[model samples]
Target: MQIIVRAYEQSCAGVLVDEVTVEADVSKTGQQSTFSVALNTPDEDGDGYVAILGNGKGGTDCNDNKNQRGALMSPGNLEVCDTIDNNCNQQIDEGLDKKWYLDEDGDGVPRGPDFISRCSKPEGNYMEYPDGQQFDCRDTGADAAKMFPGNSEVCDGIDNDCNAVVDDGFPTLGETCNAECGGVRVCAADGLSVVCSQEPGRYYHPDRDGDGQGASGSLPTLKCGTEPADPGTVSNDDDCDDADPATCEGLAEVCDAIDNNCDGVVDNATPACGGTLKNVASHYVNLGGDDWKTVSVAANGSVWVAGHDGKLALRRPGAQKFESFSHYNSAPQAPTDGSPVLNNNNCGDHDWNVSWVNANGVVFLGGQTGWIGIHTGAANFTCVPGQMPTSQDAITGMIGFETGGVTTIYVGDTSGRLTRWRPSAPFAEQFTVVNNSDFAYYGLHALSPDFVLAVGNSVTGSVQKFVSYDIDSQNPVTPPTEHVANPNNISGNVRSVWMGSATSACAVGDNAAVWRWDGGTGWSKVVGPTGVTGRFSGVVMRNDTQTQLIGQCYIVGGDGTSRAKVHRLTPYGWAKPLDIQSATANVALNDLAITPTGEIWIAGEDGRVFHYPEP
Candidate 1:
């Protein structure tokens, strides 16, 4: 028996196996049998190889023999076609001399003959192999040289080494680090790199300085040792005392120093007593050699003091102190002249009275200087334009008119004659004698421009009286037409009378007599409290509600102690008098003036001005 087989050749030698016959037909030329096996014809272009099988020697013409066959005819044709399985071993053409076609368009269809090229080629390329197998040309195929390294043709996201993932071993381009943790890979054909940022542990670092950069570690280093001190903070060594930062240089010490903690003062460092007292006289001069007796604050706030040492003192709100000189000696010779009287005894006696022209700022002073003086000063004191009287009459009381700018000075002599001096010119001429009378006008005050009230006694009867003079027309030269007697009964001489602007007045005199006049009413006696009586030496009308009567009273066995008796005027009558305490038992309150600001300045015989802030 014989069988036909195909043998693969290494090269294009085109050798074939011989056809052999079996011994079943051993008799030679027995039936003249013959057998033949055909070989395929080669192509004309010499582009193909073929396989053939033939018997080496023929024994009979095997066409007539029934049971004898020359060679078992092969099932497959011996033609060298491009179809796979040329040897027919189930896998066609898989051993050697195989060819593959690349579907460059990736359509999966190959350009080949006698085959269904419509299916996708596994390798998509026309690749040739020597194993006579047509492979898909993938990495696992026989002709897989065109595949990537490691024989892998799968698409991966990354080029593991960053070479770009054109033909890499991964299924897609290998994943890359997307600068984030545990990122995944994406398809390269999708024009994106694989994000393989699956770092085990990573964290973000904030740029504290806001420099648009991040730090590599968990905790970033600070750029400076400490933050700069804030505008007024105590850090960065800027403040001397960080604990007490407010204590710094050049700050106010208040009442502490050493900076108080550094503020730059010693102790009690701030300036002290830097402000001046308003309306207070800064310095005081000894008026009348510190023997100032009676000081009166005029209605316009000017101050005048009279002394027993024959001096008249003057002071104003801003004066350094009280200044004194004899009114007679300091009298100016002319309206424009100024003089300072240094002599203490220029006036012959200590008695004097002073009053102010409230509307005109004129000051009138009359005393035992043997003359009356009027003074005016634009800045400092200047004597008014007035000549001295030739007579030696002692002027006891003086007062300026409340209206009409009239000033009347009353001069009293031991002979019971009283004379009046009136301003005759524009304060530039000396005053002239206006009227003379036989009544002893010791204490006088002009209640108004038209009325004159004088207090004194008659020489014949020694009867104390209050006389009112009516000028009729302010004609100082004409004799007064109206006269009135003191309405109250009194047995002693009247020493003084103080007329309050509100029509209340007090008249005081010897034998502890005190009389009060309210408006146009008759005078009434002012009774004192128990154990307070002797004589009322001075009387000044305070306000409508009260009166201050200062005098000396017998304390023990006629010792003659000084006293300040205050009496309140009630609706019904005068209330009981109250005594003011004295530092010493016998201190006298000689005179009193209620200042414009309501302070009571009391003059005492001890040459002191006691100031009561408000009384």
Candidate 2:
């Protein structure tokens, strides 16, 4: 209830103090307390609007006293972008504001992420934001034509539209370009500024055999994705065989004498005795008359041939004729030094049964009566004093290597003696006989300085023996053990042994008895080709640092009269004997050597030296 007082006639207590008092009871009312008062007035700002809110009187202005503020800046005014709630909607320029983006290039497509939502666009380097999030990938430039969406991209080092790829839209963008190496055009490494340049390429290794398995730990061939039509290649490099399809990764491993599992070990499941036999074609050079006992390949591509009656010949690589030297008997020595006369002087007249060539191409010819002849270049031989510790004996087999300028030689004599001879030792101690018995070492090879493999005959028992000596090693010395199968069952001497590595070797001997060293003390028989029986005096394998080799193993021997036989080990047993030339019919191939240059050198009777290169 409201009360009004008119002070026209009877006034209240002091005329200027017009006041009233009101009261109400609230003992048990539902509400705790409720009281409010509003002074209703009209035209407070003189705009003809009341100041009371919901007093049943007309009031529309939130700020009734609009005179203190702007005259027309009220609920009845228009809203503008001045950063203030001018129209009193509890918002500053709500419907009148716009979001501006950094469009420095003025390309219409602005930067997507960075923007300013305000009443107006920024002062500089900005524009009204586009419909969607548009990125000015390169926002610094002012090329509206080229730096906008749907524009042709050039090699101007910028991403006009943020297509995620910095270098796209080029017609030949991924063409293979050859610079320092072959590579295709990919995104720049930084993935920032676009350019004609690209990062490095993926690598693909070679698959020369078209087996889809490349050489293990292989080298990259042509750059990836840019290979030729027939450019056989493999992604994972894992192959130890060349043409054998049964070898490589994911292939079944068997006892095929190859690393079928590509684990770098030759058939670890079982000891292999044969391999993929190689077919070879041989060419021979006849030195004539004296029987050539040994042939060696020198490091400088020269071939040294030593033989009976103290004969030695040097055939430079690719030379058709031999420069022969003589000692005991008068062998033809054509002087290349223009000495006007041939060299007919006696240089140690006896049979030179073995020869070894050092790294410097110096050939040491071990001869009968404990003699050794050293030949350097010319048609002259420097005879060393007798090297035997006892009576005169012919040096049967010899192998040597040099270390720290000191040459260490191992000599095998016909009298079943094996000695280590150093050129620097005293005469009495020069030939330190390592083994002296009735066990003749026909061939001795050193897999390392500490590992020596010897194949020979046990003269006392007349049986075959394969011995390995781990000299001065953690393992004790292994004495020679005779392998006596039967009176005629591979019981002949193991004449020659060639080590493929410290763990693998091949040996052959009389009676066509072929054997494979089990990388240990045991020897397994590689039964000879059926219906063919003869002697295998020499054996050689392609040198490989790894135990799993992919090349060939050759075993040679013959009858003393006709038909020199050359056999190769096969995955089954033995390949048929290589067809021998008619000229080499009477020449029984005694020994063969494969030089580091991949040349096969074979020597035999009547001063014959053959160079056999397999196809």
Q: Name the candidate that leads on TM-score.
A: 2
Q: Please list the C-alpha lDDT of all candidates, in the order they appear.
A: 0.43, 0.60
**lDDT tens digits, residues 1-615, model 1?**
444534332233434423333334545655756665553332222222222223433211112122332121112323233443333334433433434455443323333332322223344354432333332323333333333323333344322222335545443433454433334565455333333434332333343222223322224222222333222222122223322322334434432112322422332332442221112221232222344445567666676666554555555554435544444434433221132334332334445544443434455555554545555433355553222453466555566543344444544443344445556545433344445655565566555645666677666677776656565444455453333434544676776677765366667666656666665635666664345556555555544211222121111111143254433332223333333334431444455555544444545554445443211
Per-residue lDDT value at 26 in model 1: 47
Assess every candidate by TM-score. Answer: 0.42, 0.49
Weakest lDDT window of 10 consecutive positions for candidate 2:
8-17
Every candidate's CA RMSD: 27.9, 20.4
